[model samples]
Every structure is written in C-alpha cells, then in structure tokens.
Target: MDALYVPQGRSRRFVEQATNLHHFRLGIFLEVIDLHLQELDNRFNERNMELLTFMACLSPKGNFSSFDKENILKLASFYPEEFSSVDVMTLELQLDVFMDNMLSDERFCGLQDLNSLSMMLVKTKRHENFPLVYFLIKLMLILLVATTSVERVFSAMTCVKIKLRNSMGDQFMNDCLVTFIEKEVFLQVPDEKIIDHFQNMKTHRMNL
Candidate 1:
C-alpha cells in the first residue's frame, strides 16, 4: 500500500494512524450513545413508568377518569416534595373533590392534555381550589419537561461553543448560548439597536 510519498521526518505508521482515527472516533461515539440509551433504560423503571402513567389521569383523555383512586393516592403519598405530611393525608380527599368539581365545570371537562389541564386550571381560577393536586400536576410536568430541557441546552451548547469559540469565557459564552437557544426572544431584539449600544460603549474611529 506504499502509494504516496511520506514526509522524511514522519513515522511510517502515519497512514495507519489516519485509518485508526475513524475507528477510535466511531468506538467513542458508539460507546457514548450506548451509555446514554442504557441510562435511559435503567432510569425508566416499571413503577416509575406506572406512576407517571397514573399521573396522566389528570388529563381528560385516555379514559383518564377510570384510573384507580387508591393507586393515585399511593403515588401522591410517595412524593413528599410535592405533597407534605398534612397535604398527603388529605390528598385523596382533595383528589375526589377535584374530580367531582372538575367534571361539573364545563371548562375543565373540555381540557384534554395534562399541560392544557394545568394551564386551564389557572385560567378558570381553580388552581388555588385544589392547590396540592395542582402542585402535583405541575411537579410531574416540571419533572418530565425540565429533564429533557436541560439536556437539550447542554447538547446545543456543545454545537454552539465549538473549538473555534473555545477561547470564549464562561459568562460571555452563557450569554451567547442564551441568545442562541431562545430563538423567539432573540428575534424580537433589533440588531441595529444592539450594535448602536455596543458601539456607543467605546469610541471607534470609524463611520457609524
């Protein structure tokens, strides 16, 4: 395979090392992907999945109302952060009252997903009526959403803060990342105004 000339100072294995780069790269890549998938497999245990499914009962769809009250109560009792001792004790009572009240309210009856149900509760001025139950719903949503959200942010940062921008400081990089990630927020800002403000901060011997 001696097809090309090698530099006089280089090792004979230069061609071999070039070939090994792809092998090493693929090995590390697959290893990372496998670890991530394996972690997800371990994290999503049956009980956790069942509890999350039970939490979906708050939604109006999927025969949500037919969910077992005792199982729901047990799940509520387990999450002390969302439901304290006193709160947990009366959670079932609250749940029963919430279901009764919700079914009667036309606004709540029309709600479908957990998100819509959570938001509609506030719009209907009923979030306060079932505070603990509402908190549980919100907590479940935050748990489900916030986990993926943080992961997405880090993933984006890896793309954004590349080798070219590696010298950028942490605080400045964070600002850039925030601007990059929040596309809607960034869109509303006028670029000219930003340039003018920055330009005004320090005098430059150039036309504005």
Candidate 2:
C-alpha cells in the first residue's frame, strides 16, 4: 500500500493571513490615535480648568461615552483616595463597566500613558498619603506581587509535597501543609522559651 498524505486547507491558511493583516491595521490605527491623545493630554495638563473638567467627565459615573476606562483604573490604583474623593461608588461601578468592556485596542493605546500617569500620581500624593503612595510607588509592583506572593505560595505547596511523606494520611498532610504555609507567622512569634530550646538544640548539634 502506498503511504497516504494530506495537505492543510489552503482556504483556512488564507483566512488566517487575512485576519492577521486586519489586526495589524487596527494596531496601527490605535497607535496613531494614541499619539494624538497624548499630545492633547500634555497640552491640557497645565490648563487646570480643562484638566479638571476632563477628569470630572471621566468620573466613574460621568455620562460620557468617550471617557477612557483604562485612565480611570490607572488613576484609581495610583490615587485611590483622591480618585475616591469624588463619587467613589459611581466611579467603582464605572470601573466595573470599563473593565468588562475594555478591548485589546484600548489596552495597547493606554498602557504607556497609564504608566506615566501612575508615576505622576505617586509623586504628587506621596507627602500626605505615604501608605497609599507606597502601594503605587513601584512600577514593578505588579511583577513583584505575582512572583513573590503567588509564585511563593505555589512553590511552598510543591515543597511540602516533595519533602514530606508522600503516603502519609491526608489529615497529617494537611497539618504539614499548614505548618509550611505559615512559616512566616511562626517566625514572628515572641516565645522566648521556645527560642531558647531551639538555640540549645542547635548548640548541642554543633558540638556533636
């Protein structure tokens, strides 16, 4: 019997190519629009009345279709208190709406501009709102948060499974997992007598 062969569909390949080209065109359009909006934001920054008016309309519940949702989220993360000073609940609901309706195009357009806005919010509010400022002060906090907290939790879970008894009873495994999970909490415990016992054990082991 001769070996059988099949070719991929040419029409499917053509459709994929067309879709990619359309996406590229949209990406270019969003970039050009972003350049113009940036220039507008810069021009309006010093014009306080226009800036505040623009800010207000972009408020969480402002009745405008053109308000940028990404800008509101960026502002909220950076200046939660100030951003909350105005109709906070409305803004929060608006945030929910924007988050739900947010598109890839808006994300691509607003990311850099939002970064700059975040920095400005941090510097401007640092004096009075130190704790909130600390939250927004770092640009890499998003990465930091994901890597340290989330990754570490998963890592600890894996470590517990690997280092402990694989065939142990489930309840015993649960207890071990909890012990590993709250390692930091144990470190913060101020039991001096327990500390002395550990120190003595270490000293005995070293002597051996």
Candidate 3:
C-alpha cells in the first residue's frame, strides 16, 4: 500500500451516492464491477461468440474435411488483399491438391503445425505456388512469434539486467539479453569445446 501511487482524482473517486471518497466497501466495488461485466456481456453476446467458434474450425491442426470449405470461403471473404475472387475460386483446387499431397505423403501428413508445414513447403520450394495458404500460415506465424518475443524479451531483461546492473550499456545489455533469452540455443553449445577453442586462439601464452 505504501509503494502504491494514488493519482489525485482516482484516489478520491466516489462510489454511487457516497460523499466520502476514502470509503471503499467491497460490496460497492462489486456492484460497479457487475455493471462493467454486464456491459462486456452485451458487447460480446451469443451471436458474436458463435461466429468466432465457427471460425476456429478453420484451423488446419485438426482433420480438415470438404465441409470446412464454406468456413474457408467465409475467411477469404473477410480478407480481399490476399484472396481475390479469382484467388478464392482457385483456393478449392489448391486445397484439394495440398490435402491430396498430405494424404499420399507420410512426411507432409505427419506435420502438426503451420510453422512445420510452411518449413516443409519452403524446403521443397512449393510455398510460392500456394500463395494464399502459405501467406496466411506465415502471417499467423509472424503474429505468434512477435507476441512471444515481446514477452520473452521482457523476461530476459529482468534476468540479464536487474536493478544492480541498471547502468548496463545498450549494446552489452542487448547481447546478454539475447544469450539469456535463447536458453535452448545456448544449451546445445559445449562449454569444453568453447574453452578449447579459446585456448587454441591464444598461442603466445606459455606454461610459465
């Protein structure tokens, strides 16, 4: 409570008909919260939620069927930049070909995520051919990466440059943060091999 900064207006905010601003009853606060929640409920009512749920069925993670093409059409209808009328018409054939390849090939069928699927496409240099699907997958991947990277950078900054090391230089801090953030990558690096390489680089230093 001592560390908390109370803004002048917010600290003295009155609840309902109460004249005393300092008085904050849990019941009164709950009433205010109830109204706010009611507003949210009205905004995101049943119809909106049902539409969003139907959209979730567009995910290729699960088994995609012929029935889901309508959902795909709906998705393309929303985005005109990537999917044109001609593009939408071609999507059905592209999807059929993509799914058929997946069915015939073991490696393609075994993929569980869009990232892996995209990588396989790039590996075979087939991603450019399926513009809409690949671009959609890539867009989703970029969003996921950008979101996770922000959270990871903050987490890494906390670990790498704490209050004691607050005066750390920008470049130095960035370097340390990068190392701390990519723990999985650093884990693969052998310390003994690194030490040996360092020792090998220094030839003039003798055993004296």
- CA lDDT of each prediction against the hidden true structure: 0.76, 0.49, 0.67
Model 1 per-residue lDDT tens digits across residues 1-208: 2234343587877644334445455656778998998888777878778777677666666435655677677778768776777887777788888878877877776556879888888998788888878888887788788868887788789988999998999898888888878888878989898889889999889847
Using all chains and alpha carbons, the TM-scores for the candidates as numbered come to 0.65, 0.27, 0.44
Better of 1 and 2 by TM-score: 1
Candidate 1's C-alpha runs over 4 A off are 1-51, 74-79, 104-107
Better of 2 and 3 by lDDT: 3
Per-residue lDDT of candidate 2, residues 1-208 (tens digit)? 1322222454544443334445555556778889999977754465434434444433323223445645544545545555455544455555554434433223223433334434544555532433332232242345335546765666676777673557778787677777787878877877886667777775565521
What lDDT tens digits, residue by residue, belong to model 3 across residues 1-208? 2232344555435423343333243445767888999987875688546545444543445444322666656666666887889988887677667666655766665456667778888887777777776775565567567757887898788888889899999999988988888878988999887777777887757621
Model 3 TM-score (2 dp): 0.44
Error in Å for residue 102 of model 3: 11
Is 1 or 3 the stronger prediction by lDDT?
A: 1
Candidate with top TM-score is 1
- Candidate maximizing lDDT: 1
